[model samples]
Target: MKILVVDDEPDVRTLFEQRFRREIRSGEFSFSFAYSGEEALTFLTGHHSEVVLILSDINMPGMSGLELLRHVKHDLIPPPPPLVMMITAYGDTDSYNQAMELGANDFLTKPVDFTALKDKLHAISTA
Candidate 1:
């Protein structure tokens, strides 16, 4: 499976890489990273057919994840939209509700727990 990971922080990218290295190296999954929402859109435009999922940070500099989510749901053409899961430091009720209303497949808090994330991924993938 191909996954797009969008986050501004280098450390977050590194951590994701580390957490999923086994899958990546073993050919179970592949990932591409974008530093901003614009970059994510660019990647999607080119790799729309390949990408099956997106893990996005909610508090980006130029375009927030919610904005990205809206664009993914409303603006993209062909190949259908990939499943998007919003990750945020602000894990409040309002944010979670908004994310779901905006069409998020799932919501995860910052300092992401890999086991929980993996389980969610597994469930989503199987479905």
Candidate 2:
């Protein structure tokens, strides 16, 4: 599986890479990074068919994840949009509702728990 991890924070990207190194090493999954939503869209335009999932931070500069989610839900074609999971440090009802309305597959609060993330990924992968 190919998973795109989109966040402006370099540490978050590094953490994800480290946390998922075993999966990469075992060829179970591959990872990509995009620091901004525009960059993500560019990557997606060329690689959407290959991407299985996208884990994105909601509060990014230039383009927010919610905006990206809207584009993916409405604009992507043929194979459909990749599973989008939104992550935000400032989790609230409004953000949650907006994400869901925009077709986000799931939402996660910041300080992400690996165990929960793993379980969600497993369930999504199987489903």
Candidate 3:
């Protein structure tokens, strides 16, 4: 499975790489990183079909994750729309509701629980 992780934090790339090393090495999963929502949108413009899932941070400098989600769910028309999961340090009701309304498949609190994320991924793959 191919997943795009969008976050402003540089360390998130290293953390995801380390946590999913086994899956990556075994060819079970592949990942791409985008530092901002605009960057992720640019990547999706060309590679949307290749991406199966998106893990995005809700708060960003410009074009927030909810905006991205809206664009992905409304503008990008793939045969099957890629699943989007929102992650945020501020796990508040407003953010969660907004994300869901924007068509986010899941919402996760930071610091992310790799175990839960892995299980969700596995379930998605199997389904």
Candidate 4:
């Protein structure tokens, strides 16, 4: 599976790589990283078809993840839309409601639980 991970924190890339090293090495998953929403959008435009899922941080510098979610859910009309999972340090009800309303597939509280994330990903892949 191909996944796009978007976050302003550079360390997130290394963290995910370390956490999912086995899966990546075994060819069960592949990942791409973007530092901002705008960069994520640009990557999607060229490689949307190859991406199966997107993990995005809500509080990004230029163009929030919610805004990106809107574009992914509405503007980009691909046949098999990539599943979007929003991650936020502030897991407020308002943000949760807005994310769900905007068509996010799932919401994950930071720091993410890699075990739960793996289960969710497995389920999605099977489905």
Model 1 C-alpha lDDT versus the unseen true structure: 0.90
lDDT of 2 by residue, 39-85 (tens): 99999999999999999999999999999889888987755789999
lDDT of 3 by residue, 13-119 (tens): 89999999999998888999999999998999899999999999999999899899998999886656799999999999999999999899999999899999999
**TM-score for every candidate vs. truth?**
0.94, 0.95, 0.96, 0.96
Tens digits of lDDT, candidate 4, 1-127: 9999999999999999999999999888899999999999899999999999999999998899999999988888575679999999999999999999999999999989999999998888778
Q: 120 in model 4: Cα distance from truth in Å?
A: 0.7
| Candidate with the greatest lDDT versus the true structure | 4
lDDT of 2: 0.90
Better of 1 and 3 by lDDT: 3
Model 1 / residue 87 / CA error / Å: 0.1
Tens digits of per-residue lDDT for model 1, 1-127: 7889999998777887899888778887788999999999999999888999999999999999999999998899884799999999999999899899999989999889899988877776677
> Candidate 2, after superposition: displacement of residue 121 in Å?
1.3
Candidate closer to the true structure by TM-score (higher is better), 2 or 3: 3
